[model samples]
Target: MKKITLWLAALCGGAIMLSGCNMLDKANGIILYGDEEKVLSSLKEEHKGQVEKDSLSVKLMDTDGKRLMIMDETSAQYLLEKELLQEVKDGRDTEALSSIPKLAEGEAFLFAKKEDSDIGFDSLPDQVNYEGNVIIGDGRAYADMFLVVADEDFTAFEAEAKTMGIIQYNKDPDGIGGFDVEREQLVKIEE
Candidate 1:
């Protein structure tokens, strides 16, 4: 009886430890938005010619001639967290938004969204300098949508997230999305 009880206790403790560790490690494979993988799969099947596979995002030039990237939610979430971490490390408090630097001429990226129409774009203070388009294109529509903008605006976005207080950036010690070190080298983002 005593041996059985000890084994049972050890099992329960192991289970608890796994549960805690799994949140960070397993998060990379999850879709934060609704059913994103299914949507991407369907989109790929529907428009085989339009899709170009990239490591981080699916890219194409839409029928309207605007560039598009069908990014996954996790990638965006990681970038968003990366931006916020930089902001906090810079020693800027929540009130530092008004002083956000203007984005360079050619800096933008796309993010996953599911809305039928565009969300916050021009309405976001001019400092953010962001512009977005719906993932629904002329011939093909993406169910798991995206937001497009210059790569420059990521910092403004971090400040906005900080002010909102909705997202908590957790450090991923294992590195993002499980990419090998050779595939993922860190580079400094120049101000």
Candidate 2:
């Protein structure tokens, strides 16, 4: 199931972007799947020597500790609708109690969810409650790895990504030619 999800993300992310970043809502977080062993390509030729499959998993790391978590999209959406999020007329202000990994090369992300368990671990099953995907700020980067940020924090994430030489910012409204990551600054596309 996990491998299938990652494959879907890799296959779909590119296609989704082609529809234009306009399809994304800067204020909302999205479900993402990424393979750690694979480096992302702005160009296709660089992918020649890499193996096609890698194990994909969701993870969470913070002051408390790091652990493997579950992905439950419906649960995520429920959390958003039930009013667990911090009120912000523009962009979401909720904290990511749990997250999963996605993105490529140095770019990576942790799809978000609320920690609603007594143990505060893992994905919530449907009978209980669910958490929705939320955009998390910069993930801890290592070597060539990078992080993905929500529309709420695009400006700040952009500045940090630049310093790290990470050139991509998904769904930046200010992106240029659909390859906004190549641009020095973003031009937020209005809905």
Which model scores highest in TM-score? Answer: 1
lDDT of 1 at 56: 38
Off by over 4 Å in 1: 20-108, 111-148, 151-191
Q: lDDT (0-100) at residue 30 of candidate 2?
A: 16
lDDT per residue (tens digit) for residues 56-170 in model 2: 2222222234333332233323333322222221243334333333222233233333334232333222233223334322222221111232223333222212111122233
Please write out the lDDT profile of model 1 over residues 49-138, one tens digit for every residue: 221221233333233333333333344444443331122211222111112222343444332332243433342323222322222211
TM-score of each: 0.21, 0.19
Where does candidate 2 have its weakest 10-residue lDDT segment?
157-166
Cα displacement (angstroms), candidate 2, residue 137, comes to: 9.6
How well does model 1 score by local distance difference test? 0.30
Highest lDDT scorer: 1
The superposed Cα distance between candidate 2 and the true structure at residue 99, in angstroms, equals: 17
lDDT of 2: 0.29
Residue 5, model 2: lDDT of: 98
Segments of candidate 2 deviating more than 4 angstroms: 1-32, 41-112, 118-191
